[model samples]
Target: MPRLMLTDEHWSKLRTILLEDRVYDKPEHRQTMEGILYRMRVGCPWQDLPDTFGLWNTIFRRFLLWTRKGILQRLFKKLISEPDFEWIFIDGSIVKAHQHSAGASSKYDEAIGKSKGGNTSKIHLAVDSYGLPIEFTITGGQPHDSKAAKPLIDMLPYANYIIADKGYDSEAIREQVRGRNSIPNIPRKSNSKVGNDDIDWCLYKYRHLVENTFEKLKKYRAIATRYDKLKANYESMVALACIMCWLPM
Candidate 1:
């Protein structure tokens, strides 16, 4: 069998969340889940999955059903029910969109846009103080970070502070963060009239935690580059990666 990413203990916790309906046998579902993780980690086409994990098509179909049902997002939500809300860090990162990721027929935006890097997608992420992901949204690469900031901030659980880089520096964003009852720790641009002296440089240093979270997530090749034609599929891939981060905690 291929090396499994989740241990028995980790799988035990996740199994409760993923297979709550019990449509498939525990062992079979576990194997198929491993198969899905294998594809996500290695960034391979479904057909390349090895026989040890069973038929590749079966795994792919199962993944599609779960994505449609929002099962992966639910799993991530369950894992993070009681997050460390003392400090929430928000940031956005751009991922190069592979040629294969294009060609969606749906009217909905696929979160893919043509930029200098060709086609690209942006992942807007919010992580807790410990550098663990709390929530995220995908957008076209051309969307400004501040553009996605409000929605991402609105979805966060109660937090005392929200931190981000200067790219997200804007009065409207600061107002949105304040509306959530959280102080915005974003640094202002040098050209801005506001002075930096009032900003908490000490707490601002922890802003790296969100960047580090992005680094860890990008370690999964599937997340480092977009390959799913539909935004829903890409969102599911991201939710699964976030769940993996919470598994060992």
Candidate 2:
């Protein structure tokens, strides 16, 4: 209950994963990880992280190290090694960018961009039947869902069916889903004469699973809005949230 996020139960499981490589260990490791989760929950500036967690700057540096090394991303992928794939849902949602997240070095790739809602970033996510996150990507708000469909689906394992909204109604996307030996459950556009006669209406309702996953992840304040200036750092933040979703399982 001290200013920390991970419960003892959660820490036990996460400890096993974080230390699995045995590459590095320290007495402060648990506190460091807690600090990371704490920041994710509150979206506070590193220097503002509560003192009960200790030396905010120290914790922030460790997080930056892990983010740079792709440790968090790899850990998330490891937790999702086996997912409920019988039916998978994919979709995207946009997050507004905080003014504090601006002014990043131009050398780093950034995801935030101008949109009808001002600056924003979109999170493209895929979820299993149980609404657990499987894979996700970040992009500027202006890009269409189809631009991210291929790489996102490519990272996933084979599934019996792939579900999406009318935004992904393109034949190319459907064919890509077919390439995975999966049936596509995308509804056609309103303007198109071709109807959704083939769509599995019953199962398509479950497409809300991905939306729910996004909803849950966004509950963590850091994820609800874009604060990280670098795309990789933002992705690492999202990966940690996804790991939290899988951890409860």
Candidate 3:
């Protein structure tokens, strides 16, 4: 399938902003930075990054630094102001951590040791029905889906509808979502419901967009196999992946 491409104006704006933040310190820095962005945009591996990207190690290090500083997240927020946002979808997925990415001190709340996947990290992401990601939260594989739902949900305000899975069916969550004037579209758990609640199966089918969003995100090899020793870096890559998904054709 053909991939989406960034426009000249988009490139110019990104180059200007990223360069201001010391992204253009070296002759090869611009190329390296663009290379990594291209790799993220195309879901390619670092080693496989085309020769045009210059030294992969340099690009990777800069990416790590940007990740630590939360640059990618800020960049995504700036870039997504043009998206359609009447409805949002929330969901979570697990990314198996490569052994190399292991040894991160268990001190990291988002760094959970092996459970079902043997050293895997979990990602909770919220996206629009168009599969444009809004926000993400990283945690250990063992963390309950409900654990990060609150924080992830809090990132978005004034959403018309917030859709989630049955796992998020809780009185507290429902009440909290109500505060934003957004109704929860999640089906009530079989054991938890008292009476009939309207659920539109047709609209419910839209939840698959979030699922497909996860599917496309894992296409990045580094993302599919978590290698960032820091949770922030891993999550930054998730944001970069989201940017790729939101790229205009």
Candidate 4:
């Protein structure tokens, strides 16, 4: 079996999530497991993986299986619970995708179109006041930021407040926030002729934390480059990025 380079806590967490009861008797299974840990840490593409990690294709397949089975979500939820946050911030970042990632014609093919740059993928992330990630949603580059607003907001339980930009200033979203018994701290656009931007100025100041969280997430080379060819793998990279954030500095 390949070496486990993650910290003791992370390794233990991975072990619990993986549940050793599941067999890893085959060489491919062991390799793939190591390959995932390697990709998460090194943020490298499968094709660029080193030979000692075993077959890249098998690793990629295992990643897909884990993602489809809600393993990633379970891991993310566990990490999210570790943080104590009174408020959460929401934002999205576009990642430029290489042409190779566009070949897949799956139902979640949101990374195929052009955005701020060329073909790209949008990662909508929600983070708590301390920049700890709470939720993540993926959409095509062309998808509107507001399109993900309600879903991301809906994922959270009741909170003190939720902060977002003017893009999320829809009456529907405001209603959704109120429905959850949380204050919608989103500000209205300056151009909005309907209502005033009534968000508390002080609370809005902390919105930058989520922005910084996106900056940190993009620091990973794999995340900065969209090399995962598949949405699930790419999203796993995001989860790994969040996991790194949750760990002690």
lDDT of each: 0.89, 0.87, 0.75, 0.74
Which candidate would rank higher by TM-score, 1 or 4? Answer: 1
Which residue ranges in model 4 land beyond 4 Å of their true spot? 1-5, 20-34, 40-44, 105-111, 194-197
Kindly list the per-residue Cα lDDT of model 4 for residues 1-249, writing each as its tens digit: 445656667655656655644534453554565677677656666776777877788777777887777676676676555454578788888778877677775675545567557888788988876778888887778878888787788777667888888878788888888898888888888777866647698888888998898888887677776776677777777887787677553
Ten residues in sequence with the least summed lDDT for candidate 4: 21-30
TM-score of each: 0.96, 0.95, 0.84, 0.84
**Candidate 2: segments with Cα more than 4 A from true spot:** 1-3
Worst 10 residues of 1 by lDDT: 17-26
lDDT of 3: 0.75
Least accurate 10 contiguous residues by lDDT in model 3: 1-10
What's the C-alpha lDDT at position 129 in model 4?
A: 67
Best by lDDT: 1
Write the residue-wise lDDT of candidate 3 on 1-249 in tens digits. Answer: 223244666566666667666565465655655777666655555676676666777788888788878788777776675655677889889888877676767674657557855888888988875777878888888877887799888888577888888888777888888898987777788876454266666777899888998888888776777877778877788887777665552
Error of 4 at 99 (Å): 1.2
TM-score of 4: 0.84
Give stretches of model 3 more than 4 Å off.
Answer: 1-10, 19-27, 37-52, 105-107
